[model samples]
Target: MMQATQKQDFTTTFSVDRNPREAFEAITNVRGWWSQEVEGVTDQVGGEFDHHYKDVHRCRIRVTELVPGRKVAWLVLDNFFNFIEDQAEWKGTEVVFEISEKDGGAEVRFTHVGLVPQYECYDVCTNAWNGYLGGSLRNLINTGQGQPNPKEGGNAPAHQDAATVLRARRTP
Candidate 1:
Protein backbone atom coordinates (compact mmCIF):
# COMPACT_ATOMS: atom_id res chain seq x y z
CA MET A 1 0.00 0.00 0.00
CA MET A 2 1.16 3.53 -0.67
CA GLN A 3 1.73 5.84 2.27
CA ALA A 4 2.25 9.60 2.49
CA THR A 5 4.66 10.36 5.30
CA GLN A 6 4.18 14.07 4.69
CA LYS A 7 0.66 15.36 5.13
CA GLN A 8 -1.20 16.55 2.02
CA ASP A 9 -3.85 19.17 2.42
CA PHE A 10 -5.88 21.37 0.06
CA THR A 11 -8.04 24.25 1.19
CA THR A 12 -10.60 26.54 -0.43
CA THR A 13 -12.63 29.29 1.16
CA PHE A 14 -16.12 30.62 0.41
CA SER A 15 -18.25 33.34 1.90
CA VAL A 16 -22.04 33.36 2.27
CA ASP A 17 -24.73 35.63 3.67
CA ARG A 18 -26.39 33.01 5.83
CA ASN A 19 -25.27 32.53 9.41
CA PRO A 20 -22.76 29.84 10.22
CA ARG A 21 -25.37 27.42 11.47
CA GLU A 22 -27.43 27.45 8.30
CA ALA A 23 -24.37 27.23 6.10
CA PHE A 24 -23.01 24.30 8.06
CA GLU A 25 -26.34 22.52 8.01
CA ALA A 26 -26.53 22.74 4.24
CA ILE A 27 -23.08 21.25 3.97
CA THR A 28 -23.86 18.27 6.18
CA ASN A 29 -26.90 17.46 4.09
CA VAL A 30 -24.70 15.64 1.62
CA ARG A 31 -27.48 14.14 -0.43
CA GLY A 32 -28.94 17.57 -1.11
CA TRP A 33 -26.02 19.29 -2.80
CA TRP A 34 -23.67 16.44 -3.58
CA SER A 35 -24.08 14.29 -6.65
CA GLN A 36 -26.69 11.61 -6.22
CA GLU A 37 -23.67 9.60 -7.24
CA VAL A 38 -23.35 9.31 -3.47
CA GLU A 39 -25.83 7.97 -0.93
CA GLY A 40 -26.48 7.00 2.66
CA VAL A 41 -27.05 8.83 5.96
CA THR A 42 -24.99 11.85 7.04
CA ASP A 43 -27.20 13.67 9.54
CA GLN A 44 -25.02 13.05 12.60
CA VAL A 45 -21.68 11.79 13.78
CA GLY A 46 -20.95 8.12 12.95
CA GLY A 47 -23.14 8.04 9.83
CA GLU A 48 -21.60 6.60 6.67
CA PHE A 49 -21.46 7.96 3.11
CA ASP A 50 -20.60 6.29 -0.17
CA HIS A 51 -19.42 8.14 -3.25
CA HIS A 52 -19.45 6.40 -6.62
CA TYR A 53 -17.47 8.28 -9.21
CA LYS A 54 -17.13 5.66 -11.89
CA ASP A 55 -17.97 2.08 -12.60
CA VAL A 56 -15.07 1.10 -10.38
CA HIS A 57 -14.13 4.14 -8.37
CA ARG A 58 -16.00 4.05 -5.09
CA CYS A 59 -15.35 5.43 -1.65
CA ARG A 60 -16.95 4.50 1.66
CA ILE A 61 -16.70 7.33 4.16
CA ARG A 62 -17.53 7.32 7.81
CA VAL A 63 -18.40 10.50 9.67
CA THR A 64 -15.84 10.67 12.44
CA GLU A 65 -16.43 14.03 14.04
CA LEU A 66 -18.90 16.88 13.98
CA VAL A 67 -19.43 20.20 15.72
CA PRO A 68 -22.64 21.77 14.55
CA GLY A 69 -22.06 25.10 12.80
CA ARG A 70 -18.35 24.59 13.16
CA LYS A 71 -16.84 21.44 11.60
CA VAL A 72 -17.27 17.94 10.21
CA ALA A 73 -14.76 15.24 9.32
CA TRP A 74 -14.93 11.89 7.59
CA LEU A 75 -12.67 8.86 7.69
CA VAL A 76 -12.12 7.04 4.41
CA LEU A 77 -12.90 3.47 5.27
CA ASP A 78 -12.78 1.97 1.80
CA ASN A 79 -11.70 3.14 -1.65
CA PHE A 80 -12.07 0.26 -4.02
CA PHE A 81 -11.66 -0.90 -7.63
CA ASN A 82 -10.02 2.08 -9.26
CA PHE A 83 -6.63 3.76 -9.24
CA ILE A 84 -5.98 2.64 -5.66
CA GLU A 85 -7.23 -0.87 -5.01
CA ASP A 86 -5.97 -1.43 -1.50
CA GLN A 87 -8.36 -0.12 1.11
CA ALA A 88 -5.49 0.41 3.54
CA GLU A 89 -4.10 2.97 1.13
CA TRP A 90 -6.90 5.30 2.28
CA LYS A 91 -7.77 4.08 5.71
CA GLY A 92 -7.37 6.69 8.43
CA THR A 93 -7.39 9.34 5.73
CA GLU A 94 -9.71 12.21 6.59
CA VAL A 95 -11.42 15.06 4.78
CA VAL A 96 -12.79 17.96 6.80
CA PHE A 97 -14.91 21.06 6.29
CA GLU A 98 -14.89 23.84 8.82
CA ILE A 99 -17.44 26.66 8.94
CA SER A 100 -17.36 29.87 10.90
CA GLU A 101 -18.98 33.26 11.11
CA LYS A 102 -17.38 36.01 9.13
CA ASP A 103 -18.02 39.66 8.39
CA GLY A 104 -21.54 39.90 6.93
CA GLY A 105 -21.47 36.20 6.09
CA ALA A 106 -20.16 32.76 6.94
CA GLU A 107 -16.86 31.29 5.79
CA VAL A 108 -16.20 27.69 4.83
CA ARG A 109 -12.86 25.93 4.55
CA PHE A 110 -12.45 22.45 3.12
CA THR A 111 -9.44 20.19 3.49
CA HIS A 112 -8.56 16.84 2.03
CA VAL A 113 -5.92 16.06 4.58
CA GLY A 114 -3.16 13.52 4.13
CA LEU A 115 -4.31 11.42 1.22
CA VAL A 116 -1.02 9.64 0.50
CA PRO A 117 0.40 12.20 -1.96
CA GLN A 118 2.29 9.53 -3.90
CA TYR A 119 -0.79 7.50 -4.65
CA GLU A 120 -2.29 7.19 -8.13
CA CYS A 121 -5.61 8.90 -7.46
CA TYR A 122 -4.45 12.00 -5.66
CA ASP A 123 -5.01 14.48 -8.45
CA VAL A 124 -8.37 13.15 -9.55
CA CYS A 125 -9.62 12.93 -5.99
CA THR A 126 -8.54 16.49 -5.32
CA ASN A 127 -10.30 17.74 -8.42
CA ALA A 128 -13.44 15.96 -7.40
CA TRP A 129 -13.31 17.66 -4.04
CA ASN A 130 -12.98 20.99 -5.79
CA GLY A 131 -16.23 20.36 -7.55
CA TYR A 132 -18.14 19.07 -4.58
CA LEU A 133 -16.89 21.23 -1.77
CA GLY A 134 -15.93 24.27 -3.76
CA GLY A 135 -18.39 24.51 -6.59
CA SER A 136 -21.35 22.77 -5.07
CA LEU A 137 -20.79 24.49 -1.78
CA ARG A 138 -20.79 27.92 -3.31
CA ASN A 139 -23.95 27.19 -5.22
CA LEU A 140 -25.75 25.97 -2.15
CA ILE A 141 -24.70 28.91 -0.05
CA ASN A 142 -25.51 31.66 -2.51
CA THR A 143 -28.76 30.26 -3.83
CA GLY A 144 -30.02 28.62 -0.67
CA GLN A 145 -30.11 25.43 -2.78
CA GLY A 146 -27.89 23.06 -4.69
CA GLN A 147 -27.36 21.89 -8.24
CA PRO A 148 -28.97 18.51 -8.63
CA ASN A 149 -26.32 17.07 -10.91
CA PRO A 150 -22.80 17.77 -12.08
CA LYS A 151 -23.85 18.58 -15.61
CA GLU A 152 -25.55 21.65 -14.21
CA GLY A 153 -22.15 23.27 -14.05
CA GLY A 154 -21.07 24.56 -17.46
CA ASN A 155 -17.54 23.31 -16.81
CA ALA A 156 -18.55 19.90 -15.57
CA PRO A 157 -18.65 16.91 -17.87
CA ALA A 158 -21.80 14.91 -18.35
CA HIS A 159 -22.35 12.52 -15.46
CA GLN A 160 -22.10 8.84 -16.20
CA ASP A 161 -25.02 6.62 -15.34
CA ALA A 162 -24.31 4.51 -12.25
CA ALA A 163 -27.54 2.69 -11.59
CA THR A 164 -25.88 -0.47 -12.83
CA VAL A 165 -22.52 -0.07 -11.15
CA LEU A 166 -23.62 1.58 -7.92
CA ARG A 167 -26.43 0.93 -5.50
CA ALA A 168 -27.20 2.00 -1.95
CA ARG A 169 -25.41 -0.26 0.48
CA ARG A 170 -27.71 -1.59 3.16
CA THR A 171 -26.96 0.48 6.23
CA PRO A 172 -25.26 -1.70 8.83
Candidate 2:
Protein backbone atom coordinates (compact mmCIF):
# COMPACT_ATOMS: atom_id res chain seq x y z
CA MET A 1 0.00 0.00 0.00
CA MET A 2 1.15 3.53 -0.60
CA GLN A 3 1.96 5.52 2.50
CA ALA A 4 0.02 8.70 3.08
CA THR A 5 3.08 10.87 2.68
CA GLN A 6 4.21 9.23 -0.50
CA LYS A 7 3.48 10.92 -3.77
CA GLN A 8 0.31 9.74 -5.37
CA ASP A 9 -1.25 9.66 -8.83
CA PHE A 10 -2.62 12.87 -10.31
CA THR A 11 -6.01 13.76 -8.91
CA THR A 12 -8.39 16.72 -9.06
CA THR A 13 -11.95 17.30 -8.00
CA PHE A 14 -14.55 19.91 -8.78
CA SER A 15 -18.10 20.52 -7.68
CA VAL A 16 -21.01 21.40 -9.94
CA ASP A 17 -24.41 22.86 -9.21
CA ARG A 18 -26.08 20.14 -11.18
CA ASN A 19 -27.18 16.77 -9.83
CA PRO A 20 -25.26 13.55 -10.16
CA ARG A 21 -27.06 12.44 -13.28
CA GLU A 22 -26.40 15.75 -14.96
CA ALA A 23 -22.74 15.56 -14.06
CA PHE A 24 -22.65 12.05 -15.41
CA GLU A 25 -24.22 13.06 -18.65
CA ALA A 26 -21.87 15.94 -19.13
CA ILE A 27 -18.87 13.79 -18.43
CA THR A 28 -19.89 11.00 -20.79
CA ASN A 29 -20.29 13.53 -23.56
CA VAL A 30 -16.61 13.67 -24.37
CA ARG A 31 -16.99 15.74 -27.49
CA GLY A 32 -18.88 18.40 -25.56
CA TRP A 33 -16.21 19.40 -23.07
CA TRP A 34 -12.98 17.74 -24.12
CA SER A 35 -12.62 18.20 -27.83
CA GLN A 36 -14.47 17.96 -31.09
CA GLU A 37 -11.57 16.02 -32.60
CA VAL A 38 -12.44 12.91 -30.61
CA GLU A 39 -13.37 9.90 -32.68
CA GLY A 40 -14.89 6.52 -31.97
CA VAL A 41 -17.38 5.34 -29.37
CA THR A 42 -17.92 6.87 -25.94
CA ASP A 43 -20.52 6.38 -23.15
CA GLN A 44 -20.38 2.59 -23.10
CA VAL A 45 -18.21 0.02 -21.46
CA GLY A 46 -15.93 -1.92 -23.81
CA GLY A 47 -16.10 0.86 -26.37
CA GLU A 48 -13.04 2.00 -28.31
CA PHE A 49 -12.09 5.57 -29.12
CA ASP A 50 -9.20 7.62 -30.40
CA HIS A 51 -8.14 11.16 -29.54
CA HIS A 52 -5.48 13.30 -31.10
CA TYR A 53 -4.25 16.85 -30.64
CA LYS A 54 -3.01 17.65 -34.08
CA ASP A 55 0.04 15.33 -34.27
CA VAL A 56 1.70 16.12 -30.99
CA HIS A 57 -0.11 13.36 -29.12
CA ARG A 58 -2.42 10.53 -30.05
CA CYS A 59 -3.84 7.60 -28.19
CA ARG A 60 -6.23 4.71 -28.64
CA ILE A 61 -8.52 4.10 -25.68
CA ARG A 62 -10.62 1.20 -24.52
CA VAL A 63 -13.45 1.91 -22.12
CA THR A 64 -12.98 -0.64 -19.39
CA GLU A 65 -15.54 0.42 -16.84
CA LEU A 66 -18.61 2.60 -16.32
CA VAL A 67 -21.38 3.05 -13.76
CA PRO A 68 -24.09 5.47 -14.69
CA GLY A 69 -24.03 8.57 -12.45
CA ARG A 70 -21.21 7.12 -10.41
CA LYS A 71 -18.00 6.27 -12.24
CA VAL A 72 -16.13 5.55 -15.47
CA ALA A 73 -12.67 4.34 -16.40
CA TRP A 74 -10.51 3.81 -19.46
CA LEU A 75 -7.52 1.73 -20.45
CA VAL A 76 -4.97 3.20 -22.77
CA LEU A 77 -4.45 0.65 -25.49
CA ASP A 78 -1.78 2.58 -27.36
CA ASN A 79 -0.07 5.95 -27.13
CA PHE A 80 2.26 8.24 -29.02
CA PHE A 81 3.89 11.55 -28.13
CA ASN A 82 6.03 13.71 -30.35
CA PHE A 83 7.72 15.57 -27.49
CA ILE A 84 8.41 12.78 -25.06
CA GLU A 85 11.21 10.25 -25.00
CA ASP A 86 8.86 7.49 -23.91
CA GLN A 87 6.52 7.23 -26.82
CA ALA A 88 4.33 4.83 -24.89
CA GLU A 89 4.25 6.51 -21.52
CA TRP A 90 0.48 6.40 -21.36
CA LYS A 91 0.07 2.94 -22.76
CA GLY A 92 -1.76 0.67 -20.33
CA THR A 93 -2.59 3.55 -18.00
CA GLU A 94 -6.07 3.75 -16.55
CA VAL A 95 -8.10 6.95 -16.30
CA VAL A 96 -10.79 6.98 -13.65
CA PHE A 97 -13.66 9.30 -12.81
CA GLU A 98 -15.78 9.17 -9.70
CA ILE A 99 -18.94 11.10 -8.98
CA SER A 100 -20.65 11.69 -5.65
CA GLU A 101 -23.32 13.91 -4.14
CA LYS A 102 -22.27 16.95 -2.23
CA ASP A 103 -24.46 19.68 -0.80
CA GLY A 104 -27.32 18.61 -3.05
CA GLY A 105 -25.06 18.98 -6.07
CA ALA A 106 -22.36 16.71 -7.50
CA GLU A 107 -18.64 16.47 -7.22
CA VAL A 108 -16.46 14.86 -9.83
CA ARG A 109 -13.16 13.36 -8.86
CA PHE A 110 -10.66 12.53 -11.58
CA THR A 111 -7.54 10.51 -11.22
CA HIS A 112 -4.81 9.55 -13.66
CA VAL A 113 -3.60 6.48 -11.89
CA GLY A 114 -0.16 6.14 -13.43
CA LEU A 115 0.75 9.77 -13.97
CA VAL A 116 3.13 10.28 -11.12
CA PRO A 117 5.46 13.20 -10.54
CA GLN A 118 8.44 11.21 -11.78
CA TYR A 119 7.06 11.10 -15.29
CA GLU A 120 8.01 13.83 -17.71
CA CYS A 121 4.41 14.55 -18.67
CA TYR A 122 3.24 14.99 -15.10
CA ASP A 123 3.51 18.74 -14.84
CA VAL A 124 2.14 19.54 -18.24
CA CYS A 125 -0.58 16.92 -18.02
CA THR A 126 -1.76 18.04 -14.61
CA ASN A 127 -1.92 21.68 -15.60
CA ALA A 128 -4.02 20.88 -18.62
CA TRP A 129 -6.21 18.63 -16.54
CA ASN A 130 -6.88 21.37 -14.01
CA GLY A 131 -8.15 23.54 -16.78
CA TYR A 132 -10.20 20.81 -18.42
CA LEU A 133 -11.90 19.49 -15.33
CA GLY A 134 -12.13 22.61 -13.24
CA GLY A 135 -13.03 24.93 -16.02
CA SER A 136 -14.41 23.17 -19.08
CA LEU A 137 -15.97 20.10 -17.51
CA ARG A 138 -17.43 22.15 -14.71
CA ASN A 139 -18.94 24.59 -17.13
CA LEU A 140 -20.39 21.80 -19.21
CA ILE A 141 -22.16 20.39 -16.22
CA ASN A 142 -23.40 23.73 -15.04
CA THR A 143 -24.16 25.83 -18.12
CA GLY A 144 -24.59 23.19 -20.84
CA GLN A 145 -21.53 24.54 -22.61
CA GLY A 146 -17.81 23.85 -22.40
CA GLN A 147 -14.67 25.16 -23.95
CA PRO A 148 -13.45 21.95 -25.49
CA ASN A 149 -10.63 21.87 -27.99
CA PRO A 150 -12.00 23.32 -31.20
CA LYS A 151 -10.90 20.66 -33.67
CA GLU A 152 -7.40 21.90 -33.27
CA GLY A 153 -5.09 21.87 -36.23
CA GLY A 154 -2.74 20.64 -33.59
CA ASN A 155 -2.55 22.34 -30.22
CA ALA A 156 -1.82 21.25 -26.69
CA PRO A 157 -2.48 17.57 -26.21
CA ALA A 158 -6.22 17.48 -25.58
CA HIS A 159 -9.28 15.83 -27.18
CA GLN A 160 -8.72 12.19 -26.46
CA ASP A 161 -11.99 10.36 -25.86
CA ALA A 162 -11.32 8.19 -22.83
CA ALA A 163 -14.27 9.67 -20.86
CA THR A 164 -12.41 9.12 -17.62
CA VAL A 165 -8.64 8.78 -17.29
CA LEU A 166 -7.02 6.76 -14.52
CA ARG A 167 -3.50 5.68 -15.22
CA ALA A 168 -2.96 1.96 -14.74
CA ARG A 169 0.40 0.13 -14.61
CA ARG A 170 3.65 1.53 -15.88
CA THR A 171 5.89 -0.62 -18.08
CA PRO A 172 9.58 -0.18 -18.57
- lDDT winner: 2
Candidate 2 lDDT score relative to the true structure = 0.79
TM-score of model 1 vs. true structure: 0.75
**lDDT tens digits, residue span 31-62, model 2:** 88887888998889999998877655688988
Each prediction's whole-model lDDT (CA) = 0.67, 0.79
Per-residue lDDT of 119 in model 1: 60
Model 2 residue 68 distance off true place after TM-score fit, in angstroms: 0.8
lDDT of 1 by residue, 14-54 (tens): 78888888887888877667766668867778899887644
